[model samples]
Target: MEFAERHDLLNKTFTPRSPVNQRQLFSGRIDQLAKVQRAVESPGTHAVLYGERGVGKTSLANVAEQIAPIWNSETIALKVTCNSNDTYSTIWRRAFSKITFSEKSQSVGFLSETSINTRSFAETLPQELTSDDVENALQRLKKHARLFIIFDEFDRVFQASSTLTLPFSDTIKSLSDNNYDITVLVVGVADFIGDLIAQHESIERAIVQIPMPRMSSVEIGQIIDTGAARLEMAIENPARQQIVKLSQGLPYITHLIALHSFQEAITNNDANVNKGHVSIGIQTALDEWQASIKTDYVKATTSVQKKNIFREVLLACALAEVDEIGYFAAADVRSPLREVTGQSYDIPNFARHLKEFSSENRGKIIERTGQAKRLRYRFNNPLMRTYVIIRGVAEGMIPLEKIR
Candidate 1:
């Protein structure tokens, strides 16, 4: 391939900043996709896709919307993203606007002619909206086509007003009770479905909860392989394994590092990507990390004492083992802390550091959950966890060989 062609292929294959809207570019989450397919195929059933940040919830939702019509030829999929200022009525208005409907009219003249007009579904919605209003509009539209409405970033609306979810809950219940042919998919960042939607027993059975976990090593490798194959490039085993370890199970990290690694190989005029390229990729990924994340890391690790342990402690926290939801107990940090610091450590040694990390004074990089002795901690942003680990390797605190 020519130089420009390779660069173009690189751009098209790796998209760290954007969600994968095309099914061909998306990887993993087969089970999540299956659950979504089932929900879309079944009437009066909706789905909620929730997970920690950077787990590709939006990408899954996007691909789901694209493929839903394939699963049912009559299905019409529409999506609307939520913002902090969005309310229940505004959200539905945005969703409905994506749908275009047609109207036919016949002339009364001798040479009678038929005229077709197209308009947005939003035109049918009333100014003062209620769950009944939404249900009624959807019910009317169902006569022509089955609807699949995706409410992406739903957590933003919920965070703006927890009460806003009440109307959505009411709408879901109404639709299910009436056996409407419409499905609603709510996508957002949350450990539990309740974090994104209002808890209502009436709509409990009407919705399917699809929790998206981080990609596994094998799944992450598919992303690397698929992208490399598209460009007709080869990524050696060691380089592929390094990217997976550095990614720490997040797809976003994989893309970021892989994009740079491919670029590095191309610059060196080598079609094969190796560990040296991956090392450069890691450096570039950290250097180009978002300002907010860098700021938070500095805040979480900065200290006044000469013998500061904040940085080491934070790195230990990053290397700590986390459960399915990303929560880890204080005990989990001890082993990693000992490894990072080359010293024996216990809960009391860095208890204050954990408390400070969860406080606003330290940017609240890690969030504290549970209570008393049973408390667990997790990074407020999952990407921050990956960032911390990469920083460790970059600073020699963590050797590349020790990644796995």
Candidate 2:
């Protein structure tokens, strides 16, 4: 194959660092897509899509937004990406400005009727806005089309505001209460509504909560099939299974492994990927992702004075059996810690590290789950879990024979 052709195929087929392109080949999440469509069609039924970072929440939202216009011509999909410093007013104003209301010109005569083209209002958003201001803007577009506002990366708002910003919830409540021709679709990293915002009990009734979990092995296989079809290549069953096993239900990890595997195949001028290609792919993925993984580790462990404890704590979690989504409690890590370090340590001893790991913008590598008495923690980035596994073995922190 020519170099440019291979390069183009690689760029289009593998998207680890960015969200899947709207026109690109995508797979799985059929149920989530249907839920979004149903919520969009039902009047006054907004949606809240919450999940881990790389479980394809954004991809589902993006695909839904793209498909909504085709399903309903009147649907106007507006995406507002939140940053750390953005407030409710700032975010809403940016979304409001994208709205353009249109109408068909009405005329009396045949000549006038012939000239009846669609006309739209110019966007004019207020610099300083309030909940009332946003509601009023939605009201003006009532006669035109339905608005589907998608707030992606919404967790950043909470990261910026410890309380999750009450005004934002109030705006949503007010909009729902008034029965505006709008469906606010919130996409974020969270286990429940309370994690995203506070004092918004009123809006809960109007929302359709959809919690996205890890993709099934079958669904993940579809991703491999889709990518293989796109590249006009084949992934051998063993190689495909390796990718799926290592990915742990995260699409980003799948993409990373698939990308390198495909590259390995291309370099060998082979159309089929085997276990050897997959093994090399895994090593390549780890090498490429190590710098960022180390950065997060360094940042997360800086607070611990004893670097050895921090390393052992992280290694323990990585070694623990974390179900499919990489969730492991302190108890789950205890045995692994002792095995790796040849020293005994209790949960309470490293409880501080757990807190730091779950803290936002501090470590922010792991998040707490389950009830109060039985709290379990999962790595916020699935790739980090995979990284820790590889790095531990490479650094001699873990016995190479122990890796599964």
Candidate 3:
């Protein structure tokens, strides 16, 4: 059997309810999915769906149509991924491409088609469209069903270009405020967009954020059972136990683990996927994690030495396996870092690196308290720290005092 035929994991080839521009696998997050459905169906409002990577944020955007059939059976949703490369022209073209209209968009009616050009649109979009022959094209759109858009990977687009702020704030922000019945949903990592929205008047007025919560274990079990039944194979007890222990109810990791175990099982010619396969998958996962951290660390960062400097302070975070909420502190980290680096760092440089490392890790490092004095450092992902510690990429989060 081919890999697709034999590998029965949900991530491998799970079926979505509808035909979409991108492939989507809906495994869990019934609750979060339901919330997005409510927001989309509510009408007269816009929302931002933000979350960590590989946590089904984009998939949710793609499969969000699943809820449409329930509400009106005619609700139309168009999803777009925005990155640094996306511009006024690109976004307009994309909007024209994804959204349908009562009449063909290409047939000119009023505004000059030249004004629809990227550079022109960059300066004056709908305003230019109003003056150009393309106004007829846009009016044709109003004749169609109400348009809804979801922008996925929004961070990549914002981070990719520096000059894009004006175009972005104008195109997307304006789309949200135009007083049209169209609803816009933007989905991606939450890091900078929150502040970006706060800065823009139109953005602040038009947008409402609806964050996706982390996965829960009960829902995870349902996904596990669903994936297994679809595969026509049973998960061995040992594998099940190991997955539950390691996954911590995280959906992406859960699917990745399940897929890896299934592949290992098929390779071994075993009908049942067991802990041995899970153990191998776990090790492979850690190795991949180490490599990924190294790559991103190097890209977003300059040197491992620089990364290591901060590591000493975050040593307490590197070992924390499960920080559900809250964080550890830079104060607790300073002395240990000095101990590791074999040198003393003054408070100023020390504070800079501490904040820098926290910025580097961001949500991965949980905040223990809202106040600086009360704040503590916590790993955003418990398992990622565990992976780093096992690979010797980071020092233990457990203070040395506890080793005694």
State model 2's lDDT: 0.78
Residue 388, model 3, lDDT: 39
Candidate 2: residue pairs that collide: none
Worst 10-residue lDDT window for candidate 3 reads 14-23
Error of 2 at 222 (Å): 1.2
lDDT of 2 at 96: 70
Candidate 3 Cα lDDT to native: 0.55
Name the regions of candidate 2 deviating beyond 4 angstroms: 1-3, 101-122, 162-164, 195-197, 298-313, 319-327, 334-382, 390-404
Tens digits of lDDT, candidate 2, 181-217: 6888999876436854457776788888888888888
List candidate 3 stretches off by more than 4 Å.
1-4, 8-11, 14-25, 66-70, 100-140, 162-178, 199-206, 288-290, 294-315, 319-327, 331-386, 389-404
Residue 85, candidate 2: alpha-carbon lDDT: 87
TM-score of each: 0.95, 0.80, 0.66
Model 1 clashing residue pairs (backbone): none
Q: Per-residue lDDT for 130-240 in model 1, tens only? A: 887887888788999989999998888777787786677778888888888888898888643674344678687888988888889999999999999989899999999
C-alpha local distance difference test of each model: 0.88, 0.78, 0.55
- In candidate 1, stretches whose alpha carbon ends up further than 4 angstroms from where it belongs are 104-116, 195-199
Give candidate 3's error at residue 288 in angstroms: 4.1
